[model samples]
Target: MPRKLSRLTLKEQADKALREMISSYRFFPGKWINVERLAKDLGVSRTPVWQAMMDLEKEGLVEHIPKQGIRMAEMTLQMACDLYTVRGLLEGLAGRFAAENISKKTVARLESILKEQQQIVKDQDVVEYSISDFRFHGLIYDFCGNWLLKELLENIKTRSRPFVCDITPIMSGLYQDHVEAVDALKNRDPAKAERVMRRHNLRMRRRIEWTLTREERE
Candidate 1:
């Protein structure tokens, strides 16, 4: 017999479904999401779906219009840069803390994520690789033991979801940065880990800007 799956509450289920939809570009930036249709598709009531949208809104990913419904927020280049700037600082601290605090098991987890990421990139599977990318950074935040830091990072990451594809051109370099971060963490060099993490995010900002510039040129 198969193991029983754990049940999620209506709101939790709704939120997870909605988040995946948004992340996969099912709900594109600046597009209005139909509350009733989403609720019906998710097989949940409007109340829970509405609650989920509100939660995403607080993360700066969605906005509630007075009578039009929920719209996914557009990530302007400035907004992307600002978010990445703060993410660099916060994740730098998180990396420092992780260097001091990450367990051997956590190190193994990070390694596994990187291994998967390598294969994903080799296959040029951006969608699968993006999920691994999220997990890689998320581990550091989770192990950092700073509640506020984790909260802020989570919010910014969610807010940046729509723009993630913008950095695809430099995905290989991004993975290399993750590799260096893991090395720093393994060595437990707090300063090195912090610096590498900051530089990693800074590079992401630069890559996004480059991508935008090329897009404008085209």
Candidate 2:
């Protein structure tokens, strides 16, 4: 039993480490994954790595092709459109629900996160900024009062990670969007908050679309 548990632990560790690599863009979209090479990279046996890839496949983060073995999920144009559409609707609903009943303390905490976000943006820490950005929206989701919607949004965010060329160029705009979102929430204007959040997502989708269209040229 101890030996079996140890193997389970290694598989879970490999799964978590692979997820980190995916988040950091080390294993990018559409890239073929070599099981043996990945085992070496994660410092684990091929069995655990293969098992981890199987788990990721279930999560839609990676897929097993008949001839290609395993590959990271690619964000196709249709997938992008569907994801951002659902994302916009759900995020807008979350903002509306949060504005309806969020506490003052929670709003204050969100403002604090924004301040930290400002510093991270100015410091050009893209990764840190991304983390805080998600936190800001996630906090709103926590107050959304709809567990199923929140769960759907979280799943979509993971399964539909977009392809961005450079994040540094968009940090300021994103910060401004957060400011407007929090401002609406501060005033308890549900309609305005929903509109602002939806617009923010629309703009992001447009940006990704442009990048996708221009990828071949670059």
Candidate 3:
């Protein structure tokens, strides 16, 4: 007898495959991805692949090019600036909320994340460091107790992953900013926390600007 196919299992498989493709730059920025070839590579049929593409499209990671099928969404300096502007506002609000409502347990958890981040920086493990960076903001969003803000930040994080990952190498100053932000949270100073968070995001925009300038010159 043949094995039964599971819809839930297949969707999960497709989601994971799509995430890997996006994270690894397999579906590289500005490049058209052949869905049929991707389906074959993942050992699935076109149906699941198409489903995964739809999910990615909803997250703004993939674009439908009409006759060209699907392509990775390209990043531009204008997009980066616009994203960072929104992020600064949302994340600054998160920091302020955290300062007001942060528990001792949450502070401890933030410290632990910071310690791990410090080690990753010392080891020069850029990939792990970047993952930790994501987790740090995720923790703040989760602790803020605002479901809507949390979901929005999560979506923006997914959409911005390619640009963020591409710029991880220029993040040496980020660790100190994290430390300062956490310290502000510990002190329960919402204003200070918001300032630190805004400055951190502005730094990210600056890095993106530098990268765009270099690309333009090239």
Candidate 4:
């Protein structure tokens, strides 16, 4: 006989379904959430669905208004700037920590990912390449020796995906940054590794700032 699958409570089921819908862009950012409709769609009661939205609200994936109701979190130009700033700071620290924990195996895995990223570029798949791009940075955080940092970065990526794709260009120049970061780790240079990672994210931040500035002008 097959093993019995663990059963989820109604609230847990609703929570899982809600997260999937949000991540898949089923609900666009800032769109007002219809709890009754969502409950019906998920085959759950409105109470469980409402509880789930409250949980997502704490994760910064949704918002609750005073009288209007709930909505998906919006990524304003300023918010984009702030997210990249945190990404740079945390990922830069991941670089430093990873350098301290560097090993031949880590270098090998990073190099392997870089080769895959190259193939993604050659194949001209922007979406696939974007995923590989995140994988490259995420691998560093995995080896950064801080579980909390890794969890935080992963959460940020999950929430930032739609916004990042819309606002940031995935350039060949970013691929070069990955190469340099791995090389720094191979050379066992903590400062340089951190610097390269920070620079990589700062480039994106600069672009966000430029857009924000231009919008203010317009």
Whole-model alpha-carbon lDDT for candidate 2:
0.80
Backbone clash count for every predicted candidate, in the order shown? 0, 0, 0, 0
On a 0 to 1 TM-score scale, where does candidate 3 land against the true structure? 0.85
Q: Tell me how candidate 3 scores on lDDT.
A: 0.81
Best-fitting candidate, measured by TM-score? 1
* lDDT (CA) per prediction: 0.83, 0.80, 0.81, 0.78
What is candidate 1's lDDT per residue for 154-196, written digit by digit as tens? 8777777877555567788889989999999999999999999
lDDT of 2 by residue, 1-218 (tens): 01122444888988777766665556778889888877876666898888888988897789899976999888776677777888999899999988988889999999999999989989999878867877888789888888998888777766655354456777788788899989989999999899988988887787777777777468
Worst 10 residues of 4 by lDDT: 1-10
lDDT: which candidate is best? 1
Which residue pairs collide, candidate 2?
A: none
Model 4 off-target regions past 4 Å? 1-6, 9-27, 32-49, 65-69, 165-170, 211-218
Order of the predicted models by lDDT, top scorer first: 1, 3, 2, 4
Tens-digit per-residue lDDT, 64-183, candidate 4 = 998889998877787877788898888888899999997899799889999998887677776667667777877898899999999988777667654634333546767788899999
Cα misplacement distance, residue 190 of candidate 4 (Å): 0.9
Model 4 quality (TM-score): 0.76
